[model samples]
Target: MPHSGPSASGDVTGAGKLDRDVLKVAAVVVLGSIMAILDTTVVNVALQELTVRFQTSFATIQWVSTGYMLALAAVIPVTGWASDRFGTKRLYLVALSVFLLGSVLAGLSWNIETLIGFRVLQGLGGGMLMPAGMTLLTRAAGPQRVGQVMALLGVPMLLGPIGGPILGGWLVDTVSWRWIFFINVPIGLVALVATTVFLPQDEPERADRFDFPGMLMLSPGLALLLYGVANVPGAGGVSRPEVWLPAGLGAVLVAGFVLRATRIPNPLIDLGLFRDRTFSVAVLAMAFFSVSFFGVMLLFPSYFLLVRGESALSAGLLMAPQGIGAMLTMPVAGKLADRIGPGRVILPGIVAIAAGLALFAGVGAGTAYWQLLAALFVVGLGVGAAMMPIMVAALRTLRHREVARASTATNIIQQMSGAIGSAVMSIILAGVLAAKFGVPTSQGQLAAGAALADPATHDAAAAAAADSFGTAFTWGLVFMVVSAVPAALLLRKAPLRDELVPDVVDVPVGKTVV
Candidate 1:
């Protein structure tokens, strides 16, 4: 369908109004996203179960999550070009099918090695889905509706984390660990069908040749960097050569990609996207916010299961407040940004999150449930307000043609930041535990958490573990505060009419033109 706006040669010149097609696009994308986002959190709660099932150490088992993330980062950079080459709708269906197959294989895995390999396949599918879907929605909506559309799109991102753990825990406890992966199949199928029926079909655009050199440099660099960071907990600390060597190599590769991209006419991702002031600030803010938010997400389930001796189901239920808070605020935040500007909303949102993290820093083993719930809710509100608005601001500032590159850059940055957050926080938690218990952090955390499950030593281990987690959460607070600086740099411009919907004929706010 053409944009519901004036064409360049047509007589529609005033501000463009939003149409129902934008909402339709948002709904289609959110369904696919729910499958992907839910899978991530479900696995987080299942990490401990995987360790015992596989007879492996925490260090080895963490690879399941790390590998998935690394694969996601590796594949995300090429999505911009791939979407253009294959056509977004065709690529989306293929990606969904790939993910569905990976999920089935994951459920049948005979060993940890097989499981991780299958997850990598899932990641490959997921990497394309997010950016491509975002590009499709942004194009369909135009700049005028980015904020409201982002709110609708943000639903899966917020709700998945909230619901995944609860569902994952129930399945793990009542059924089997395999069910976590198996659950994606039904959801994926539904999304695939809905998309085929509802989505607009576009002809493939003329895309440039693949940037193989750029891909080789960027993908491996990201994978290696995340790999090195993920090893920090297992290797004891950042001072270890195991942590430094791959990280150093990754830095060199990424720098090379940047230099190479500068000279090339069409790179894997357009580094030029960063030249837009709104886009740059939005990316930077999201990077900082992602590190803190994703890091804490990893920390929380373990805290509940290990430090508080809660069941996985209980821990998941406890995590619900955060998502609920986000759900409540996202629509409001989106509308506010459309009127006032993202920075105004984002600044306060960042502060609220920092305050919530501060509350976590002060938590003790015996802290009441209500206190943690309140803080989590505050954190969710901040997250809902900050995250998608920055994305909206960034996309709104770009021409419609640039939305693909913008979405790619956004996905890559968010994934890398999340990978970094999870690894760094894991290292911090492990370090604190190792120091407190006089053992390697990875081994200590696993042993202590496992020990707490036993009735005899539950109380003592809980107290000690809680202190270690509290300290690690303090570091998360620091990251959140640092994120605010970039958020503050964001421009104060409200969303404007974009060039993509030149076909849209301006209409009255409450009036519809068919």
Candidate 2:
């Protein structure tokens, strides 16, 4: 559907005024974003408890994570269409309601399969919330406050991942893992009510035809690719047909989606957006950063728990310093991006990230607690500074109509990159372990059990894991460095115009243009 002028009826915030009501609406939108972001990591600390509850193998339980991620990938691309077809306010409310229902179902799930199914339901709604929230907030703020709004909105987004493990760990220890899902209920309800009361019912004038074929190709392609990566730890490398086949097919399907999108009117993704050099660079940089940062984040927790013999609660505690560092830096970095441009902010941010990864590479089973915290703090600083700038930079030249699509694309890429990074790191770690000790059972059980048995074996296994992790981190550092170079070179030296400029027509000699 095509959006009319900014003041068209049903606009979320009424024309041209920044009033208390608008702020209230924006606050509600941020709450919705928080709900989505929190779910991303809330399950991390509960994996062990879930494993026991499900009575499933580690390989099988891991699907709970993989399934949610796949569902997120599948649903994200369709959000722009959904919001446009249904009014923004209407869709936002529906999405939140669906997410709430999913959370309720998850808490009451009878088996691992049902729990995973519910998680997918949760992901479906969650996958749209951030982009939808951004749409509402940006349209309401009217561009002058994009920086401030993004900075404010980022607080919960940054806090969620950091807090998720801590919160989940505490819940599992103090109550039950079900509480983690249950916690979303009240927050979701609040957001839903606030959205209904505050959000404007902006419906687009003309509805575009849905591109079912494009979605069919892209969604499963992404899901299969991520699924393949998630299974790599247990399934081995390219040598394992099961590992390679799905990944290969996914790649082919994605290529087909790209080709099809280029020829279609109102494609699922407007590939032409990549024509803008700054947007292209920003997207690429974001993708690489996600690979490096999320790969480390996903691995570090397990490393502490398995290698250092820390309890899940202790592991969560150890990760707190990193979150603190990120929290400390994001607002300042966000403001800096506003003042000096994202290029300036991102360049140094990537450098810090690389430095942090280098420090992480030095960590071992015998590393001191303070040293681990220090490494994490450094990494968090890099993450804090890098992410917001990448987001703001990509949207700097975009119009209000384009923001949802752009945000969705950025998120999909980040998720896919993280999945790939996790897979690659897992493969490296698994192979190193097998070579150091021996191959586990066909299901990868023996390797897991051996690491749990003797301290010597555990330490040896950890060293091998650390070595592989270090190698991946080094590559991640290189990716950060390389990504920063292009971003620094391509991004605008100064901020672009903050307002959404309409497409203007060129008037030629003796020509009348609308």
TM-score of each prediction: 0.84, 0.82
Residue 2 lDDT in candidate 2: 31
Best candidate, TM-score: 1
Candidate 2 RMSD to the real structure: 6.0
Which residue segments of model 2 deviate by more than 4 Å?
1-20, 23-27, 48-63, 108-115, 136-152, 193-205, 229-241, 395-408, 441-450, 453-475, 491-514
C-alpha lDDT (0 to 100) for residue 209 of candidate 1: 78
- lDDT per residue for candidate 2 within 97-157, as digits (tens), equals 9889999999999998899889889988887777677767766655444545666677787
Question: How many steric clashes between backbone atoms does each model show?
Answer: 8, 0
Worst 10 residues of 2 by lDDT: 505-514
Off by over 4 Å in 1: 1-31, 55-60, 131-155, 190-205, 236-241, 276-278, 395-404, 454-456, 491-514
**lDDT tens per residue, model 1, 318-415:** 88988888888877888888778888888889999999999889878899889999999999999888877877767767776677567666766777
